[model samples]
Target chain A: MHEATLAANVLKIVSRAAAGKENRVARITVSVGELAGVMPAALIFAFNALKKETPLDRADLILIKEPVTACCDDCGTDYQPGPFPYHCPACGSRSFRITGGEEVRVKSMELKKEI
Target chain B: MCKTDHNHLEDIDLDCLVQEEDLRHSDRLKAAFRAAGVRGIGLLGSPGSGKTTLLEHLVPELMKKRRVAVIEGDLATDNDARRIQAAGAPAVELNTDGACHLDASMVETAFAELPEPKPELLLIENVGNLVCPVDFPVGEEIRLAVISAAEGEDKPLKYPAAVLRTEGVIITKTDLAPYVRVNPDKMVAYVRDMNPHSRVFLAHMDAAGKLVTEAADGGCSLEDWLLG
Candidate 1:
């Protein structure tokens, strides 16, 4: 499943970050976008499967689902996407550039330190 | 002097170590491409669209004129890579394990196992998927979206993202047109409605078993208008 691959990638990223810091990871924030084709339920399942034996096994994964929205670069109208549609809401113009919501990044972390 | 600077250093660290780590991985992939001297052409499509078969024929002809290397991505099995190797070129098999698509970092690792890029062309046969691959850029110069006549005419409309992003489209299994109920005109219209600029080709296996094409000059009318 695609979720497995995403889980592997998350472990690869998180494990390296956790090295030399703390024994436990308090929380990890991941940004997922609608257009990125990630299903949250599936991702959560994948997370559970992969994190079972890892150092950050008990870490909380905070997934932020970024909306699929774009703004009219010409008319400056903010638009929300409807069912994978990419055209601008008001103008029906595909020429409007995407402003935000296509991000897939691991933003920040809350660490648990040793005494 | 130190007492005056004790207001607090703000002590805020917004560093995302994963970002840098991922970049390093992508950079590794770029380095691999650089070493191969190969330009990548990504082939994307739905399952059973004859992408492997088309490449099975096209790669040999391309190799005759220039050195060609291929990177085959699939959810499982190295079947496509085996076929490419049989066709006579260096090939790398990337088993995504279960991933529906190939990302740049995977390519980087695949590149590591290959020889220096002496080839003039590199063909990246993406996982038999149209959706996820379009979102990830794998340092390719062109994306070739493959579709078979057996699938239906509404493919372009159904999966606009693949058609919209690709530089060209290949209509495969044209030799089976007599046996299938596909309408070439309707397919052309849908392609036009979604992506006005994408190039469409009717590719079939020749009697000599070579992949033959009629022309490459046609385009979607709306795409033509937009570009014009």
Candidate 2:
């Protein structure tokens, strides 16, 4: 649902990165965390719909999925949490803070060159 | 290698957060609220989560000492706005129409439509989908994730982003917990499992669907959490 916003922002970043350089984009790679609240299919749909005839048209989107990772403050161990009633597997500490799995970022963009 | 094999054009290293501009706009709004001595609180949850009911009780209580305003976000109809207005506060209805969530710019526009003198506390009751709303800040300095006890204990697990993004969690309809076979404490625990920094609040509703104002939880009550 929010992928359209994300897709628009991807175009913004792409526009900034490609200015005075290339217009045709070949691919855009984005990293999405499992807990980032982004649905991949929906994002692809939004991107495709927004990228028509623009620099991003025909540009492939590559998503790197990052799973939710939590770090135990007690033992300082990082572990992927299971569904519900989550706790640190190592120390069984519920005081652990989430260390990852909320990223929605553009890592790189490939632009097509005439030559 | 074939001449056309070099399909690579130019690789630009972005390594940037998506929607930085949008998030920055929200930050600016947050700063403006703080500077204006206004507190922007966003309430997000599922449909039928008692968000409007909480506001019906909360607005009057808040109006007793503070200037209160509300922006009701819904896909259609201004029913929530009407309810808030009846609760003794000025409210603006924001119909997203088809959008799943409200954003910073939308809040800014709606905030302007509110009747002045500007509110000391602004309650933005966001559209009722947990997944879409979690990603939009909407200029709220304090975001409370509202969950109905009848929705069961697995909601936090199912929507961890809502738990993680929100500053607090308000478990509403606690009086129905017994019938729903849902443990409110377990729901609170699940929130803690996802976010150690989130403040937790419990709210009980009376038989008439009104907030049980006197019922309080440990360390924090709904009033103290929202007011202060």
Candidate 3:
């Protein structure tokens, strides 16, 4: 769905990073948060579908799925809640805020250097 | 070539390089609108969730106080935009073609086409899809997720991302609750439970065909919430 747009963005960045370089991109690692509303499989499918004949054609998209982490404001305890009924496990407080699992970003790229 | 040079590999630390550019388009649009003192809201919901109907009622009421404009996002046709225009607001239609959601770039292009002296408030009616739109931020001050009563009560729990990400939730089609066997109260309760920070409202049509929305208990009115 929206993964196509995300893939396009990734390619744009990879192209810019590879600008003026003779290396071929081998792999691209991206971190997708569980709460980021992006499906990893769809993103990879989009990357494969749209990267043809481009610098990213040979690049393998590596997705790192990050779990949701909630931090309790009162007790300063960080914990990962289950898929449902989010609450601080230690303090039984719902005042905790999600500290992680809300970002989708390219972390790094592996390139094959030319001799 | 030397054996060592043939197998050489380099790892570049991009580390959020794409995200740096991701904020460029939306951030620029937000700054430009903010400088002009124009506030914006991204309205999202499932297809046939009464979004356009709600807008048909809200735009005129809102116009009584502040100038309003709408940016309608759809897969094809300018029907929603035309409807909003008929409702008496300056409207722009962005046909995403095949995209599931409207991105910041589309919003930038549509905003540029809007006439000078932008309206005080802009409501971007995002393409009718809950999942994809939740991930894309279109430089709006507030995000409103609409779920109709007919869509079932467990939608908020099922689509947690949409509920959690929105600043407000509009539960529309309350009049159809009985026919659809949905308890509007329970739906509102579920939405509140999922996201305690979001303001939830129940919208229904009155006898005279006016859209009336009442904020759930402990929630503020849409006008007050949006204006503030």
Clashing pairs in 2: none
> What tier of docking accuracy does candidate 3 attain?
medium
What residue runs in model 1 are displaced by over 4 Å at the alpha carbon? A12-26, A71-78, A83-86, A96-102, A110-115, B1-24, B31-36, B74-79, B85-88, B92-117, B131-138, B154-167, B174-202, B205-228
* Model 3 spans with C-alpha error above 4 angstroms: A113-115, B1-7, B17-19
Task: Give lDDT tens digits, candidate 3, residues B1-228.
Answer: 112234687788787734565567678878888998889899999999988998888898888888889999999999999999999999999998888988888898898888877889998999999898987778898999999999998888888889888889999989999998999999887876667678889899999998888998756777767665
lDDT of 2 by residue, B121-166 (tens): 9999999998888888888888998899999978988888899988
Steric collisions counted per model:
4, 0, 0
Q: Which stretches of model 2 miss by more than 4 angstroms?
A: A75-92, B1-8, B213-217
lDDT of 1 at A110: 60
Predicted complex 1: DockQ = 0.26
The lDDT of model 2 is 0.85
Using DockQ, give the best candidate's number: 2
The alpha-carbon lDDT assigned to residue A73 of candidate 3 equals 64
Summing lDDT over every window of 10 consecutive residues in candidate 1 chain B, give the lowest-scoring window.
B1-10
Q: Which residue pairs clash in candidate 3?
A: none
Give me the iRMSD of candidate 2, please: 1.9
- Model 1: how far residue B161 lies from native, Å: 5.3
lDDT tens digits, residue span A53-72, model 1: 88878877778877767666
Q: What is the TM-score of each candidate against the true structure?
A: 0.70, 0.91, 0.92
Reference A-B contact fraction recovered by candidate 3: 0.71
